[model samples]
Target: MLQSTTGIERLVLVPSLLRSLLMYLQLQKRKDALACLKLWVCSGETLVVSLAKEFYNYFPENEYKLCNFYGSTEIMGDVTYHVITGMDQLRHQDKVPIGLPIDNTIIYILDSNYRPVKTGEIGELFAAGQNVAAGYVNGRDPEKFVENSLAIDPMFAKLYRTGDFAKLEKGTIFYEGRTDSQIKIRGHRVDLAEIEKAVTSIDGIGKAIVLCYQPGEINQALLAFVLTETNITEHQIEEALRQKLTSYMVPQVIILDSIPLLVNGKIDRQSLLKAYGNVNNNDISFQNGIDYKGVPKDQMHAAIALFETIASVLGKAARSTISIDANFYNIGGNSLNSIFTITALSDRGYHINISDFITAKDLGHILSKLSNDRKNAYLSGQTEHDYTSELLKDEYKEDVLDMITTSFYEKADLEQWLMPNIYVEDYRELIDAIWEPLVDKRLSLVVRAKNGEIHGVALNFDARDEPEVEIKSQLNIVFEFLESIEGPVRDNILPPGKGTVLHSFMMATRSTLTPGENVSIMNFMEDEVLKLAIERQFAGIFTTNTSPLTQQLGSDVYAYETIHDCQVNLYVASDNTKPFAKAPDSQRAKVQWKPV
Candidate 1:
């Protein structure tokens, strides 16, 4: 038997090790597991910020210092250490900082130019110390082991550039993201690791991976695959991200049973992309639908229909097993499946939205909400505007102006925009200024309820004729932005001659109706506008806005183009299967036209 005379006070382990010890205690086999330890040091993956509190919560008799060590495999385990105290220290935070550098190790947070970045600014982490590995065996990439001329003697031979994004604050080193983990989505540089950190900060998310799936030439999708411990709605996750990140930074979050890992314990990114495509055939499937098979038969008719719609979208295998209560996420549903399901249901005369499907708890809840919304928001009246005549009539002008004012005022409130004192007449004047130019354009429409109250309005006009200088400048910037992004769809998106912009759209029922109903209104409005654009062969249908919801709700099955900072998104109508089918057959043909 092995024996040691040393009484262990400090315990160094990975998070998995500590979890295993806790599991043993839960089984009642080892109530005093690791009771002799005074300090428990954790390394390897980011230590859960609340691990210290959790340990005490489960085993009140045991008390120990829980330290989270941070470093990479190339740096021989740890470079910094942070001793955690309580959950209060981590409230609203992602993870504990790696803390100050260990003895004999020096860490530098530097920008891309290799200059020291300001404290609290995210930058690549570089290590200069005796503990840093002496370069990879067999001569690997030299970029990682480059020598820094500014380094002092003992550590002069090499300065390891760890690719890890981090920031230093008050002598503590906090991990931010990874340099290699950045992705360019719709011309915006997105850091996937940042998303993962944000997701893990949420209460119930066990782990998360932000993955980019580039299926082919044009379709690039960013999806968040997460391991959640408790039931959470997608909207809740989205709302949390909305508070911490820009709208463009929020990726679609998909809950999973577990994160797929490689044999060596690192994330299997390829597997995640594969599962994203074939969501039905993954390890995350709803317990193979065994629980679903046992559901009661007397569920509501709407619930049955919703379940069938989900099952049909998931494919043939799911039709028999997916119960009325089965979650779309657990039963092989994904974003792609969701789009198809909603489209199919719409064809079946059941209007719904992707947001509605993802936010609901289950089929029963969604059906109940859907039933209620339809009864309350039923379309009672309609006045389709004929652009050939006066588009904005005197009778409808007040209600239209009211819708615009209310919507814009709400936006102003949310953004905290300080504007000059403005009344209803001021709003009416601006609306009139934009409305006069649409004298003969068939691109404006309004829908009203039976009470002769306007419930919806869609306004589109030639930006070239806009009277306001601010509006013209914005449209000019949007045109330039679209022309800048090079892709097969660029030609189709570039303003042909004069740009036709859909500047304003809002449903009065937006405040009262469910997301599904609002989406229905949006879809109707977009369809009407797109038909007008197609009939006229207008340059491009675009909207200038900062909100991502505008594009998400409007660009259904359409080829979408966006210029990130400008908040200009152009939606071009085409076959969903081949969004850029109208583009030139070959790049050579376009370059051939250019004068050399």
Candidate 2:
């Protein structure tokens, strides 16, 4: 339809990245239709890089130039502009940023402290420009429109907070996500915009809309509606998402023919919520409570068959309808039901790695890849590490106690604040008291070096069920410090509660010849702790002692929240879970029903 648009030289409008790419693709095929369209000016939402590539591929690079503009309704429009040439498009292949601020506009990316954030750090975007409106009609929103006291120029003292999260990279500002749209799932902070970016990055995916199944709750799950022509399963999409995002950040993919849009052409989020509001996303899997009788003889065939079954389940179609080349995503596969497919395959003794499945070209390709990986592992004589892992033995009890006490005493001078004398002695006593019980429950690991010397020891077990006077006192002191943290910090700390807490009593490492050996031992112990947590389904994990290695490990892998007080550093790994500090309920607007 757009192929006949003659003499349309400059396309200056707000067309979605997907829509624009489609038009360009159709026009490029005819060689007449978008030929006149040069200097494509786009603004409205941030453009995804994949969509930009389509434009560059379909249209002549020298002829057509893409411009990305950024602005808000309050700031009129087109405050900042970024000309996307071949170089700019290639440079920002992941995301096409909003570029620099306009000539007269003063922009600031400030954190919650209202201080400028480092480059690439996400912060609230503020704009102070001539186009910025003075105030609302009735009265200015104090939160949105604030006096820019930090401004160097006294003339531009007023700045409007856009409530949009953005990251500045080399003078270019990339939209992260909206502050109000960001939500917590499984205690992890999830940016819907980040998810949308990942979704649109997929080869066949056109657009994505991610939403929180439930807001402001622990059981909250993420749901994603994706528009794509490729046959992709939920699990396959999930596997891809897992590579880009954390486990909690991966949303349940739902294939939609088209996104529900309002009259204004914006996504109708309210209508979407109303439709899927009551559906329990956690139980959206198709393999839930299904009984299977037979397994395929060929391993490769079995893997492909599993994917086909998963596609059928998610797409609500018969297995015969699915083709070998069809991707799971195009066939109604979603992340919510991918787990079931994997589980079903695992049940049949075919252990397929999710990572391989995510990047597979097609169903047959995934099965062949899985088969090849297994053959390669077998042919290469690959085997698990021969490291000894066992419960704390009665004979080594004294040795274990001495190792921990000696390490603490030695490191006390350096970390006196963290390794207080009282806490050290308390830890020793606690370990001594629980040694026998822990041995009975098989809850400790003592690793030895190649020279037969004790290298490291880690004690991880659920200790929430029974709490003695000493333990209770220690917890009370920790809780007291948390309480002392008045204001925002207090709210961000993990709340005190009891729900299967795994305590790492003493993770001590003996002096090694090299720092690399020490790191290896530490990593091995961390793996053990993670295994225990996964096996026992621990809601939270804690380390009584803190070291540089453990602290970095916590922040890097498990998202541990550290509490610094009482001359002791307690590290809590609750999936970096923090309660949202909400405004006072009384301050919210209220509407009362009056008699008609």
Lowest lDDT sum, 10 consecutive residues, model 2, at: 587-596
> Model 2: number of clashes?
15
Q: State every prediction's TM-score relative to the real structure.
A: 0.48, 0.51
Question: Compared with the true structure, what per-residue lDDT tens digits does model 2 show for residues 1-596?
Answer: 55656667777655564474566567556765666778788787667676677677667776679888888788887777777777546763577878888888888899766789999898889998677888888885667788887877765688888888889887788877887775543223357887887877777777788887545321234777887768887667777987887544667777877677777556788777666654433343232322222323564366555654564345322112344465554343433234345445555555454444443455665555443344452233223433455658888877687667655544421222222223446556666667777787666788876567777888765544433434432323333333343213323443344445566656777632233344446656766766766676665565532333344345433345554422222223134422212322211111111010
RMSD in angstroms, candidate 2? Answer: 15.3
Specify the poorest-scoring 10-residue window by lDDT in model 1.
587-596
- Candidate 1 lDDT, tens digit per residue, 1-596? 12222587787776755765664566665545555666788887767665555676665322556788888878887888887655555666656788888888888888756789998888889988888887888878777987776676755456899888889887788987677776544334467877777877788876677887662122345677876767887658867887887554667677777666667556678998887667554433222343434334553555556665665555422322465466665444433345566556655656544445556567665554453343232231123422121244557777677666665543321111112123345556556666655434545777654455556677766534444423332223323333343332324644444643333323332333333334445555655666666666664565543333443333333334443332112323222232223223321111001000
- RMSDs, each prediction? 12.2, 15.3
Colliding pairs, model 1: none
